[model samples]
Target: MNNPYNLVRKYDIMLKDFQTISTSFLVKQLPTATLFVDMKLRVVYASDKLISLFCDEKVNFVGQSLFTIFPELDSKWETVLKECLTGKSSPMGVQSFTDAEGKEKFYEWSNASWYDSDENIIGAIIQINDISLAIESDVALDKANILLKQQSELSKIGIWEYDLQKKTVYWCAMTKTIHEVALDYVPDIDKAIDFYKKGHSRNAISMAVFEATDKGRPWSLKLQIVTAKGNEKWVLAAGKPIFEKGKIARIMGTFQDINEEVVAEIKTKDNAKLLKTLIDHLPLNVFIKDRDSKKILVNKSECDYLGVANANELIGKTDFDVYPFETAKLSRDEDLQILETLKPILGKESISVKKDGSETVFLSSKIPLLDEDGHATGIVGISLDISDLKQKEQELRNLINVTSLQNKKLINFAHIVSHNLRSHSANFSMLLDFLVHEKDEEEKVKIVNMLTQASDNLLETLENLNEVVTLSTNTQAKKEKVNLHTKISEIQQNLSEIIQNNKLKIINKVSQNIDIRIVPAYLDSILMNFITNGVKYKHPDREPQLEFSTEVIKDYTVLSISDNGIGIDLEKYGSKLFGMYKTFHTNKDSRGIGLYITKNQVEAMHGKIEVESELGEGTKFKVFFK
Candidate 1:
């Protein structure tokens, strides 16, 4: 395929130049590092110093996920980063982190939306400058302390120090303000320790201070403290011990109010828990699994359906443990396929089995769970049980079939009335003409006898037609379970003399207990039509062979009757196979009404018939009944 946008041609030239210029420019910039990201959250270029500063390895960064290198970034960072690439500039931010060696580090980062020569938005350029040493320099600390002394009224920050040698405490004005105390109040080290809250917060502060003073360790902790007003406040208490000649002299620290942020964070976590609780109580089956197919979470409905007491019993387990081997394999493969394609599978029909051994049909959907870097990490699947819906669907189909069968019978009835009556009336007129033309008494008597026989034949045809009309009108018949083999046995016996005279062989393969939902009379009539047709159409060259078999399908039972007899030319007469007064054979016994009435009776009981035949060989009729 040819490239539509001609991007391939452009890339063919630009990529070679990019590797040279971009790599060289990044290397020359050295410790002032920068990273270029494509729209896909992948690093298109990274400076050597950027990798060394954060990862400390000669690891390749190009073509790797930006989040893979910086996993601490969350959805908020992703949104801002993508916004930058979409032509919005992000705010300048400074992040404080710790290095692998446990040294404090800070980085200042800013984003710029970059574009290609054609004015197309390519990606975002993020420049990162290491500023830890600059921020921590003694000159800067001194300058900051001086500015703090000059200001004296910033309410969010406070400074404090402890003198180990003198066993004294000093609190700045902001510190006293934070404690809600008088500026002239005097305090010692022990009195200052009483300000922390009574239990965990006080103990944590004490431990942190001890480590700072005894081991020259700097500590940053978030804890609650009690003010002089007797109200609790959250504070960030950070301290660094000052050592002189390998002996501890003093410890200095800062405090900032963090109570509001802490409260908001707690509420966010509680909201997440509440959302999970809501999902667990929903009426569908829902579950989440990891990339390895281990269960991460399951809703209440899923747990109940799987026969597990609760999600606790399922966590960390695979489907192989909770389901049959084949079902588990099928389910796991679907989950893996969704993850691999990063696409959702919606409304897929599936089957499940209940604890009581009944089967249920349902619809399921699975979605890929992705990380901030847009990598699929797991899958979430939901299944809604549609067994009741399926049952209703089958009922509707059965009703439609019954209605259609009734309509077919109505049309055939109209044809029988018009065509059969005309034929018999014509025969009556021809017999009268013969009686009028006769000149001898013997011939006239013979004509009268022929007319009597013709009238009797017409009456017989009318009786058969009446039987068909009654079959179509009767709807109150009960559908009892009829054993198919027993029915065929009774039919064969009724035709025993005919079968024996023809030297016929009967093979009954139907199960003895196989039952079908059919009216008793309809069953007898349907079997009789096919059985007699098989015998009547037997080949002159061979003895007749009949075979009967049954099969159970999803919604019905099927009965098949096979015979080695003269077969029907379905191509020639298929459209009128069950029409009124239509016959396909030259035999005198083919009244043409047998198959038409047979089809009506079959359908009157909510059954159907299909025929397959080769002209010279054999015929097989398959009947379906509920």
Candidate 2:
């Protein structure tokens, strides 16, 4: 081992073997075109590929100068080659070139000084690689990636890559959009999972990742996640495991915005549930039948009506199973009419027999349920048992007829009584006149006064009866919009003389904007009667003060007339306050007809009259109108 001569000889043998092997591999089989040239730029070694490329069959290229081979190239190549000879390395670069025969080629080339056995720089080596197709393919791949990024953003689809080796996440531009995160946001595995909802979506994705990493599985799932902006979205997460060394090395997937689609699906399910709950709890018997006239749905009430234990028992059953053939046929005909006309059949009456063989009447409303294309898919029927309502309607009709007959008889009897009373009083007046002349002077004067009294009483009684008849007979008001303040002002002016004569002070507190629906003729009378009655019934102990005001309640406008007068002792005569010819006050002008007719007139205009009073204080009459 210490012998330098033997060491040198063994090293030389090994060096020669390496040279022979490397030279053969480079010259005959190396894919790259390589050449060696001396410091003077004359070719020393030329690979077969290089020689074939730069030299023609007629030219002996083994000793040819590189300048002659590429004479059209500039001095830049010489400078680079000379620099390589001086032990400077040339970086690889690509250039497009054309041969002398006008063919196009692309070359990636570099230069380095070749070494000999003595470790001294011998000459420069030139290496060239043809990358024409590779360059074109790289250009095409770049354009495709740009277009893909644009499309991903437009479609709201984001791509993500999970690197198992580095345990990091790559979020593409569209992934940022889906997450509503800033473009510059960086993500890790934990953070990405955190973006998913903290429950099912998170757990599912975690499991999916675990399965992919441990078992090399792929997964696609629709799930929900919370976004960076605090919005919740539905997304489709699909992952394909990329394997290296028989284990998952990466997972690539897509995140699609399925918010609209998922939300719509959720709403559809909610609506179906709501509809089911509503129909089941409703009291009305509801049923839906398909185009074949078979019941497809039934509510709880419909099931009970058909004597079935559950609603599902009635499914796919025809009405003939639940009712008589004739009745079922009639029902089917009505359903057909609804479908044919494509219109709802509202308030139709029909009868069916129950399981107990009892007849029941129904008021049914049916409509065709149409699909999106406007084709009728089925009929939805809603029915109510109207037996009791029909019975009550008949009773109401009979009562109305009886009341009408009685009213007519009462009117006739009143007219007859008036006629006989008028006739008798007329006879008494004539007789008294005859007797006044026939008797002596003293007797004649008494008889004449009696006759005049009889005549006056008869006329007063007739006039009151006429007023009552007129008030009672009219049912509807000849209505117009009557301003409360304007009418009150007009009534005050009309009764100005009496108001002044009686020392009555009228305070009209009603608003100018308060208006009511009332008969124009009746409005004046109503206000006048209230005022005159107030003035007439005023207690002698105080001055008559009348205040008119208006207030609005729910759905009604109220006009209140208050008086500080001798309010009637309501406990004594409240019931007769508005009674016919019932007078409680000692005032000579207190004809009970005034309040009675006021009541009738108020009612005819669809208004209500209510009074609040104290015996020695004041009476307030509030009229409520719509």
Best by TM-score: 1
- Which residue pairs clash in candidate 1? none
Cα error of candidate 1 at position 514, Å:
4.4
Q: What is the lDDT of every predicted structure here?
A: 0.84, 0.84
lDDT of 2 by residue, 1-626 (tens): 58999999999999998986788566756566887888888887777787667667567776778888767556688888888888997854776778787977787878889888787988888888888789888989999998987878677888899998898899988888889989999999999988899899999999998898888888999999999999999999999999878777899999899899899999999998899999998989998999888999899998887778977788998988877788888888988887888999998887777646798789989999999999899999999998888888988986687578448646754875578587767878686667856848777777777777777877887787777677667766578887889989988999999999999999999888887878888888888998898788898998899999888898889889999998878888886677666788777887667887788787767678999999889899998886
Query: What's the CA error at residue 220 for candidate 2, in Å?
Result: 3.8
lDDT of 1 by residue, 557-578 (tens): 8888999999989999888888
- The CA lDDT at 379 in model 1 is 91
Worst 10 residues of 1 by lDDT: 352-361
- Candidate 2, which ten residues in sequence have the lowest lDDT sum? 405-414
Return the lDDT, model 2, position 446.
73
Tell how far residue 232 is off in model 1, in angstroms: 5.8
